[model samples]
Target: MALDHSLVGVASDPVERTWRAGDVIVYALGVGAGAADPTEELAFTTENTAGVELRVLPTFAVLAAQARTGRRLGDFDPARLVHAEQAFELHAPLPVDGRVQVVSTVTGIADKGSGALVSTENTATDAETGKLLVTSRSGVFIRGEGGFGRSGPASDDWRLPERAPDEQVRYRTRPEQALLYRLSGDRNPLHSDPAFAARGGFDRPILHGLCTYGFTGRALLHALCSSDSGGSDPDRFDAMSGRFTKPVLPGQELVVSIWGDGDGAALFRTATDDGTVVIDRGRVRFH
Candidate 1:
């Protein structure tokens, strides 16, 4: 079905979401935390132990993103929808367990002739205090659902730094990474069942894009925000925006290359250990 331009600017009903300490640990595990070395990411995957202060991964905000924005956009086929791009801003550190109000809005829609780019923006706030926690921006591509009328918005000028990375981090993705990540709200067959993935043109189940995005966030935090004394300081994170350049298979070792712009902006690229860029044109900014 074609996209109904009128659906743009519509807002979804405000919803309340609460997470427990266990929930945060599960989310951390799903995104590849502590799987290889528990000591490295223990603050996220393990808690209640001596000297451990549980913390939530900044990218977890996307988990509370618009769950039903596509349906509200129009009668577009769910099978053809693809998460095209994602951007996020963190205002404050998320409590290990607390209640938050989530409200989603259909911010904009762009017709690209062959498909429509639907944008949904989600804001999660402290349920009681009404303080904003995170703002997540998402864009989905609806195949064969464009050509109604409107032209797309102007493109962003986001570009990588000209120099090589100042530092790099390498992490190996577990073969069951997709299986673990699927438990964190996204049950897409493309990231789970192999038979279902074959139908979608993949050798086996692929990793969820958000899972990869979370990993990048982890890398950035470790590289740019870790305290000189040892632990991570969440205040260094401000925003992240990037493009999904290719499909990342389960078990692929990923290398994150980071370049700092001296102004708290980080330009980065995630690639296979073999050097195949998977998430390109990435940018991370910090407060």
Candidate 2:
């Protein structure tokens, strides 16, 4: 069935979500924290490290803002939908353990000839204090569900810089990376079940797009937001957004190339070791 355009601009009822220190740590590990060196990133991966307070990764906001009570887009095969873009802005450093009231809205539906891009925005607020915590925006492309004759909004004026990147960071994913990342609330069979993946036209299970996003966020956190002492400072990491241009398989090395855009912002692209651009049109703002 085609997507329900009437859902656009409709906000869902608030849903409350709670997380603990353990949940935060699991999310860290799922995203490759402490993988290179067990001793590194203790603040994010350990809760009992003395003199090192437990901290949350800024990208965790993506999971924190997810709400299952949102309006249904339509009744189409789930395999036909894929994440196309993601963006999130943090209002403050996320607490190690907290409760949030999340509300999601279907922001827009754009026709792209071959497919439809359904965009959504979610806001997670501190349940107790009522303060806004994070705002997340994402788009999903549903194959064979377009051509309704409605044009979408104009695209952003994003372009790659001509010069070389200021810095580049690379990290390798484990063969079991998708298995680990799946523990953090995303149980999509496309990332785990080989048979389900085959239905999606993948020879094997593919890594979660958000998992790749988390890896890229880690590079940005350390390269641009680390403290003078070389410790990752989550507070300095503000906002990030990117488009998923290709699927990433497990155990592939990710190379993040960043070009500084001046005034505490940058543009980036995440590619595989062989130079396949998996995530493109990336942008980030930091302090």
Which candidate ranks first by lDDT, i.e. highest? Answer: 2
Error of 2 at 211 (Å): 0.1
**Which regions in candidate 2 have their CA more than 4 angstroms from the true location?**
none
lDDT of candidate 1 over 1-287, digit per residue (tens): 45667767777777888878887888889878887788888888888778878888878877754344334566755656667889998888778887888888878888888888888789888889999988999888877887777776787886777778899988888989888888777898878777877765678778888888888888888888876668776667888888887789989988999988768888899998888898887888875
The residue pairs that clash in candidate 1, if any, are none
Q: How far is candidate 2 from the true structure (C-alpha RMSD, Å)?
A: 0.9
lDDT of 2 at 233: 92
CA error at residue 261 for candidate 2, angstroms = 0.3
Q: Write the per-residue lDDT of candidate 2 for residues 232-282, one digit (tens) a residue.
A: 899999999999999999999999999999899999999999999999999
What local lDDT does model 2 show for residue 228? 75
Residue 113 CA displacement from its true place in model 1, Å: 3.1
